[model samples]
Every structure is written in structure tokens, then in C-alpha cells.
Target: MIFPCILSGGIGSRLWPLSRKDRPKQFLPLFGGESLFQKTAKRVNHSGFSAPIVIGSNDHRFLIGEQLSELGITANSILLEPMGRNTAPPALMAALIAEESDPDALVLLLPSDHLIRKEEVFLEAVRGAEQAARDGAIVTFGIKPSEPNTGYGYIKVVPGEEPVRRVDTFVEKPDLARAESFLKDGGYFWNAGIFLYSAKTMIEAFKTHQPALYEGLLAVMETRHSDLDFTRLDADLFGKLENISIDYAVMEKAENVACAPVAPEWDDLGSWSAIWTVLDKDEDGNSSLGDSRFLGSRNCLAYADQGLVSVIGLEDVMVIATSDSVLVAHKDKAQDVKHVVDQLKSEGRDEVDRHPRAYKPWGY
Candidate 1:
């Protein structure tokens, strides 16, 4: 069975005033009705796929369980970390646990929050990467670049066939000029952060590339135990491990790295600007949600949760409103919203960490 290891450990500070620390963007229902997490859970519930193994925050245990329950889906396990230690440890833990059950089990690691419009194409890519993964290749899915997006990291892949190819190198998010250069260069693709590899294969890669981290995580796993519906990692031991992303920990340094170039229409939904782009707009390029209206507004996005929001003669603006706070930003300056969140955090503002309506085990 192919295991889906869903990573759900982000605060999503970028899309703040709407997305908060207590309830991140993944849990919010931005689209039709289903939340992004629920949508992701439904996407992978296909033939040859097993129940997902969710790696999420300890505080979000109830939210995770409740959301999965709403869809009549159950996870294989809910691994709770004492603190956020990035992707490497939980990824290693999932592989270790899967290795115990079946060393050859394919682990498909994906983010909990992402928009994938084309399910069939994505499933095909997953199936396509299975063979390469079984052959000891740590395969990551790459998106065909449509623009010189400076927000996402780029992957350099060697020219090859339809499904998979040798990954040349991974590049950080570049500046405007470098991003444009990459867009001109036909070999670059956006890193989707989706990985597929066999349990034994990934474990070996970790051993070879990040030996110390691998060993330390193994030691922490030995002390792991159950907490009701969650598998709790030993707090003291886990805190001592290095906080690093899986990309820097293993994939970049590993020799058996591969890239599955896919055109599945995926987006990380990372910022307000990204959200505006995906949202349906009117003739004047205006998009509004809740009790919101626009008059003579062009290229403006407005959201109102509690009250009526109206925009008049506004251009290239983002207006988001909740019961407690409202945000008005220029479309080009939407990326700077996180700076506001950072300042709020430094000032010890409650708005930085939570919304007016708090989600709980019982109700919001």
C-alpha cells in the first residue's frame, strides 16, 4: 500500500487576518465547501492508496481528528510532535514506522495545505514515480513553470522522458532577474515539495546523507508512545534534534534524487496575492466573499466574514475583514502582510496568534 504522509504543521502567517496561528489556511474552507485539508484527504483516497498518516501539531490533534471524521475518513496514525521540528524528523519517523510494517512500502509525503485542480494528472504522476522510487530514487514532483514566480523554490531537472528524470539541483527562491532567467531557461521547474519513495530507500538516503539527524531521530522514536488517538513523540528528545526542512536535510545531499515533472495545476496558496489569483473575478477584476460588494473596483479582492464590506473606486487593493480586524493592502504589497504579523507577534498581540472565533474540540 502507498502511504500518504501529510505534513500539517504550519501556522500560515502569510495569509493572516484571515488565517491565524490557531487555525491555519489548510483548515479553512476557501473554496466551494470543503477545507483544503479535507480536499487533500479526498484526493489521495484512491485505488492502491492506504489511509493517510498525518504529521501535525500537538495542539491541532482534535482539529485533525474532527476534520477527518467529518469526511468519514480515518487516518492510519496521527503523529504529534511536542514542538515544530520541521519536516525531516516526522518524515524520517513515518519511513521508520512504515519500514517496520513493510520495508518496501511507498511513502508519498505531501503538504496538508495545497491546491491541486487536476486530480487525474496528479494521480498519474504519483503512479509514474512509484517505479523510480522503488528503484531507490527519492522522487519529488515538479510543476511546469508558467511564470517567473519568485515566491517558490526552483528545481533544476535533467532533460528526460514523460514521468521522471535525474534532479540536477534545487535552487532557493530567486530575485526578479534570476526568476526571469530561470523562466527563460527551459530546464527549471517549481519545487512542489511532494515526494515519493520507498520506506527502505528513504531510510537509506537519510543514513547516507544526514547520518546524525537520522540517528538522533531514531533514538527519539524509541521513546515514542501513544496519547489517545495521537502518537506523541518524546518531547525532551525531539526538542534536541535539529530544526531543518527535509529538502536541506536529505533530498539535496542524497545521491538517489529524482524529479517527476508534472502539470497537475498545483498551487501552495501561500499568500493573499496567490489567493486572489485563484479566486474567481468579475469583469472589473474584482473578487469578493461573504457579504461584500464592489463598485467601480478593478483588480481588487475583498472578503467579509461578519459584516457587509463594500469597495468603491478602488484599484489593485486587497480588503479582508473579520469580526476583530480588517486588512487593506495593495495587490502588489500583499506579500508584505507577513511583516504585519511579525510585528504583531513582537508586540504580544493576540491577533497574531488567533482569530475572534476560535475552533475547539466541540465547536468554533
Candidate 2:
């Protein structure tokens, strides 16, 4: 059986005004009152998958629990991090715990906030990567790029006919020209940040590549205690561990790494432009939600929550109107929404952190 380890700790700052610190984008109902986290949980709940193990922030523990409960699902375990330390340490901790029950446990580490259409294809990819993962390979699902997207990292896979190919190299986010070149070059895949590996295989990789992190997280996991239904890690000890992503700590340097090319209509939804790209656009190239209407507008996205929103004589514009705030940006500058968040953070504005309809243990 494969265990899905969902990492739900990121505070998505790019989709601000809608995505907030307290109630991040993952927890919000982005699609028909179903959150991305809920969608992710449902996606991995197929026959070959086991009950999920969630690794999330201390602040959003109740949100995770309540959301899962709402869907009539019970998690295998909920591990609470005292603070954010990126992916490396928490992944290591999950592997260590899984190894306790079964040494050969296959752990599928995925972000709680990605949009992957075509569930059958995604499952097929997971099944195909199982063999490589069992053979001691840390397999990462690499999305076949549909365009020259500069927001995502790139994975250079070696030329091969196999479903799982050796990773040639991992590159940072490329500029426009470089991204276009990679698309034309045809050997690169978008680093989707989804990984599959056995407990023993990942443990061995950590022991070799990151010995200090391996040992520190091992010790910290030993001291992990259960609070109600959630597992709580030692805050002080976890804080002492190095803060790094799995790509930088293991996948980039490890010899036993492979890339599984998957093109199942995947998107990280990191920005409003990405959201616009995935949504169903009309003939005029406009996407909308809530009470929204567009007139003489092309390539525009309008989201209205509390009232009617109309866009007229606009092109390549995004308008997100919420109960408390509104964000209007050009489609090309969708990624720059974080700058507004930064400015608000500098002024210590609560709007930068959370929404007015805050989620809590009981109710909003």
C-alpha cells in the first residue's frame, strides 16, 4: 500500500486578498465550495492508496481535522510542526515514522495545494513509479510543460525509453528565453515537487546526503508526542534542524534519483495568471466566478464573492473582489501580487495575514 503524505504548511502569498496567512489558499473553497486540500485528499484516496498522513502547521491543525471530517475521512496521522522548516525535515520525519511499521513502506509526498486534473492518469503515473521507488530510487513526478512557464523549477531528465528516467540535473526557475529554449529543447520537465520513495530508500538517501539533518530529525521524531488526535513535534528541537527543500537537500545531489514524466493537466496555481490559465474561459477569453460579468473584455479573470462584479472595456486584467478587500492587476503582472502583500506586511496590516471570515475550531 502507498501512503500519501500531504504537506500543507505553505502560506501562499501570491494569491493574496483571497489567500491569507491564517486561512491560506489551500483551505479556501476555490472550486464549488471544495478546497484544494480537500481535492488533494480525495485524489489520493483510491484503491492502492492508504489513509493519508498530513504534515501541517500548528495554527491550521483544526482546519485540517475539520475539513477531513467533513468529507467523512479519517487521517492515519496528523503531524503538527511547531514552525515552518520547509520540506526536508518533515519528509525525513515521515519516512522515519513509516519505517517503524514497515521498512519497505512506499511514501508518496505531495503538496496539499496543487491542482492535478485527470485522476486516472495521475494514478497510472503513481503505479508506474512504484517499481523504480521499490528499487531504491527517489522518484519525482515531472510535469511535461505545456508552455514556457518561468514560475516552476525544471528537471532535466536523461534520454531514455523507460517510464522512470535518471535525472540529469535540476535547474532553478529560468528566465523567459531560457524557459522557451527548454520547451524547444524537449529534455526538460517542470519540477512538480511530488515525490515517491520507500521508507528505507529515503532513509538511506538522507543518511548519505544529509547526515546532520537525518540524525536531528530522527531524534526529534523520537520525542514526538500525541496531543488529542494530532502528533506534535518538539518545537525547540525541530527549530534547530536546517531549513531546506527536498530538491536542494536530496533530489539534486542524490545518485538514486529518477523523473517520471507526467502530463495530467497539472498546475501549482502559484499565481492568479496560473488560475486564469486553468479555469474555463469563454469565447472572449474571460473566466469568472460568483456574480461576475465581462463586457468587451478579453483575457480577463474576475472573481466576485459578496456582490456583482462587471468588467468593461478591459483586456488582460484580473479583478478579485472579496468581502474585505479587492485586488485588480493586469494578467501579465499577476505574479507581482506578492509585492502588494509585502507592502502590507511592512505596514503590519492584518489583511496581509488573514481574512475577515477567519476559520476556527468551532466555526468562523
Candidate 3:
């Protein structure tokens, strides 16, 4: 059986004001009516997939359960992380829990934040990945880079291979010159952070690559406490475990790692600019999600909810007016919005991160 494990615990500090501690980007209604989390959850409900298990923060227990309920979807299990110990530990935790029911279970790991829209293409990729994973390969979904993007990390894979490529190396987000060289060479793919593996293979990979993390995970799993439908990892012990992503803890060092290239119209909305690229806009090349009016605007994005926002003579800019705070910045500088957040944090301004209408476990 293939069970989808949804990793839903990022703070989304980069998507501040709209996305916050309690209400992260995944749960927010950013793209249309359905939240990103709900959309991602629906993907695993396809014919080949079993019920999913969501691994999220303790603070999101009610949120996960309640939201799934509203979507008329029931998760098999909702595991609560006592603290954010990153993907490796949470993956291990889910592996332990899934092993109890089906020791030979194949786990399809998905991030709750991405927008993977092309269902047929995405599902086909997952099927291919499952076959490789069944053959003892630690599988990852890699994206065909449309541009030499320095902001995204690259997966150096075997050249000339169509779709499924044997991962050569996982490279960091490089400088512009290096990025250009990678694009020209044609051996690199963008790391989408999606992966598939069997419980047994995952356990083995963790043991081989991240022995300490595996040991700590073992300890945490040994002390795993269940409450209702959720398995809560021990707080003190889990917190003591190092905060490291799976890419560093395992994928970078693992020899059997492979990339299953998926062209699923995917985008990780990490910044405001990414949102603009994914959204639908008007004739003047502008997109307004809620309430806004624009005149003589070209290549602009304005999200207004608190009140009517009218902008004129705006070009290549983003104006987001929330209840507490509004963000107005050039599209090129959208990535630097985190700098504003940092400044706010230094000044003890909660508006930089916390949204006005906060999400709760019961209901928003």
C-alpha cells in the first residue's frame, strides 16, 4: 500500500502578514477558494493512494483535523511534532507509525505548500517514482528548469536521460554565473523536495546516511505518545534533535538517490513574485485576488481584503493591504520582504509576521 505523508509544518515567515505562525501559507486561501493544504491533500486521494498521514506542529492538530473534515477528507493519522525538528525526524516518525500497520508500506512524501496542478502528469510521475522506490531507489521528484534560477537549488543528474535521471549530486542555490553554466550544460534539475520510498528503505537510508538522526529518531519513536488520532513526539527529546532538512541529512549523501522528473505545472510560492507568476491577471497584466481597483497598471499585483484599494500609475509592483499591515514593494524586491520582517522582529512588531484573522484547530 502507498500512503502519502504530508509534511505540513513550515512557519511561512517569508509569506508574512498573510501567512503566519498559526495560519501558514498552506492553510491560507492564497490561490482561489481551496487552500494549498487541502489541494495537496486531495492529490493523494487518487485511485492508487491510501489514506494519508499528516505530520504537523502540535499547534496545528485541530487545524489539520478540522480542515480535512471540512474538505470531507479524513486522514488516517495526524502526527504532531512537539517542535520543528525538520523533515528527517518527521519522516522517521511517520515511518515508525506506518510500519505498525503495514511494515512493507510505500510512503509518498508531499509538501503541503506547493502548487502541483497538472494532476495526470503529477500522478504519472508518482507512479514512475513508486516503481523506482520499489527497486530500492530513494526517489525524488525533480523539475525541469525553465530558467537559470539562482533562488532554487539544483539536482545534478545523469545527462540526456528523459524524465527519470540518476541523481549525481544535489547542489546548493548558486550564484548567477554558476546558474547560467548549469542551464547551458543541461545536467541539472530543480529540486522540488518531493520524495517516495518504502518504509524499510527509508529506515535503511536514515541508518546509513544520518546515523545520529536515525538514533535520535529511534529514541523519539520509542517515546512516541498517542493522543486521539495523533502521535506526539516527545518535546524535550525531539527539540534536542538537530534541525536539519532531509536534503542535507540524507539525500545529499545517499548513493541510491534518483530523481523522477515531473512537469506538473508546479511552483513553490515562497515569495510574492511567485504568487504573481501563478495567478490569473487582467488585461493590463494585473491580478487582484480580493478587493482592489487599478488604473494604468502593468505587471502589478494587489491583494486587498480589509478595504477597497485603488492604485494608479503602478508598474511592476505588489501592493498587499491586510488588516494590520500593508506591503507595497517592487516585484524585483519581493524576495527582500523578509528583510522587512527581520526589521519588524528587531523592533518587536508582530504585524510583520502575524496575520489578523488567525487560524485555529477547531475552525477559523
Candidate 4:
């Protein structure tokens, strides 16, 4: 059985006003009244996959449970991290947990916030990579880039016609020139951060490449306690474990790494501009959520949380208005929203953390 291990520990600060520390983008109902987390969970709820294992922040434990219950889906385990420790630890932790049941079980490590428009294509790619994973290859799904997007990392796959190709090297986010060059050069794929590997294989990879992290997590797992339906890790031990990504800790260092190049119309929606692209637009290229109206606006996005938002004579601009905060910026500068979030953080602003109306288990 392939265990889908969904990672949901991102703040998504770039999508602020709508996405906040208390309730990040993954939990927000952005797509047809469903959050990205719910979509991800539904994607793997079919026959080929087992009950998902969610690894997320302890602060969002209630959010995770509530969302899953809303969909009538129950997770195999909801592992809570006291604090953020990046992807490496959770990757190994999932492997360790799955290994307890079946050492050779395949674990599909997925990020919960990504949007995969073509689920069939993505699942077919997963099915194709299953044999490679069972053969002891740590398969990373790489998206075939439709454009020279500098926002994402790149994976260089060796020339092959096979379903799974040997990964040449992993490249960090590049400048525009380098990104374009990668587009011109064939065999380059966007590092989608998706992986499929045997539980035992990943555990051995961690033991070999990240021994300290492996040992530390082993100790942390030994003392893990259940909090209702959630699995809580020892805060002290987990915090002490190295804060590193799986790419840095294992994928970049392992020889068994492989790439499954696919095009499932994937997007991470990392920024407001990204969100604008995915949203339904009108004749004037204006998109809005809630009671919003546009006049002479082209390629503009306006989100109104509480009241009606009206835009006039604007092109390529975005307005995100909540009850407490309002943000207006050019679509070209959408990525810089994180800087605004940083500035708010520096000022110790409450807006940096949550909206005026907070969501809780009982009531908002």
C-alpha cells in the first residue's frame, strides 16, 4: 500500500491579509469553497492509497482535524510538530511510522498546499513511478515547466525515454537569465517537492546521510504521546533536531534519487499574483471574491472579506481587503508582499498573526 504523507506546515506569508499565521493559505477555502489541504486529501483517498498521515504544526491541529472531518475522511495519524523543523525530519518521521507496519510500504510524500489541476495525470505519474520506488529508487516527481518561472527550484534529469529517469542534479532557484537557459536546455523539470519511496529505503537514506537527524527523530518518536487523535512529538527533542529540508539532507546527497517528469498543471500559488492567475476572470480580466465590482479595470484582482470592494481604472493591480487590513499593490510586485509581512513582523503588528475575527474550534 502507498501511504500518502501530506505535509501542511507552511505559513504562506506572501498571501497575507487572507493568509495569516493563525490560519494559513492551506486551510483557507480558496478553491470552490474547499481548502488546498482538503483537495490534497481527496486526491489520494482512492483505492491505491492508504489513509493519509498528516504532519503539520501543533497550533493547527484543530484546523487539520476539523477540515478532515468536514470531508468525512479520517487520517491514519495526525503528527503534530511543536515548531517548524522543515521537511527533512517529517520525511524521515513518516518513513519511520510507515515502516512500523510494513518495511517495504511505499510512502508518497506530498505538500498539502499545492494545486494539481489534472489529478488523473498526476496519479498516473505516481502509478508509473511505483515500480521504480519499489525497486529502491527515491522518486521525485518533476513538473514539466510551461514557462521560465524563477520562483521554483529545478531538477536536471538525465536523458531517457523511461518513465523514471536518473536525476542529474538539483538546482536552486535561478535568476531570469539562468531560468530561461534551463527552458532552452531540455531535460530540466521544476522540483515539485513530491517524492515516492519505500519506508525502509528512506529510513536507510536518513541513517546513511543524516545520522544525527535520524537518531534524534528515533528518540523523539520513542517518546511520542497521543493527544486525542493527534500524535504529539517531544517538543524539546524535536526542536533540537536539525532544521533542514529533505533536499539538503537526503535527495541532494543520495545516489538512488530519481525523477518522474510530469505535467499535471501544477502550481504552488506562493503569491497573490499566483492566486490571481488561477482565479476565474471576467471580460476585462478582473477577478474578485465576495461582493466586489470593477470599473475599467484590466487584469485586476480584488478580494473583499467583509464589505463590497470596488476598483476603478486599474490594470494589473490587486486589492486584498479584510475587516482589519487592506492591501493594494501592482500585480508585478505581488512577490514583494512578503516584505510587507516582514515589516509588520518587525513592528510586532497583530495583523501579522491573524485576522480581526479569529477561528476557533467552538466559534469564531
Runs in model 3 deviating more than 4 A are 358-364
Best by lDDT: 4
Off by over 4 Å in 1: 360-364
Candidate 3 TM-score, true structure as reference? 0.94
Backbone clashes for every candidate come to 0, 0, 2, 0
Residue pairs whose backbone atoms clash in candidate 1: none
Tens-place lDDT digits, model 2, residues 1-364: 7889999998889998888888898998878778899999999888888889999999899999989988888998999999999999867877876777677799999898899888789889999999999998999999999999899999999987788999999989999999999999899999999999999988888999999999998888888899998999888998999999999999888999999998999989888888899899999999987789999999999998788999999999999998889999998898899999999999999997868786653555
Model 4 residue 160 CA deviation in Å: 2.1
1-364, model 3: which lDDT tens digit per residue? 8889999998776676687777788888666667889999988887777789899998778778877887788887888888887888767766776778897888888889999879779888888777788888888998878788887999888876555669888999999899999889877888988888888888998888888888987888788678997777778888889899889888888888899876789898888888888889889889887888999889998888678888799899999888888889998888788888788889998775566876554434
What C-alpha lDDT values do all the predictions have? Answer: 0.88, 0.90, 0.83, 0.93
Model 1 has how many clashing residue pairs? 0
Report the error of model 2 at residue 151, Å: 0.8
Q: Residues 1-364, candidate 1, lDDT per residue (tens digit)? A: 7899888888888888988878888988778867889888999988798898899998778889998998898898999888999888877888987777776799999898899999899999999889998888999999998889999999999977758999899999999899999989889999998999899988888888888998999999888788888898788989999999899999888888999999888888988888888888899988887888999889998999888999999999999998999999998887899999999999999997777897643555
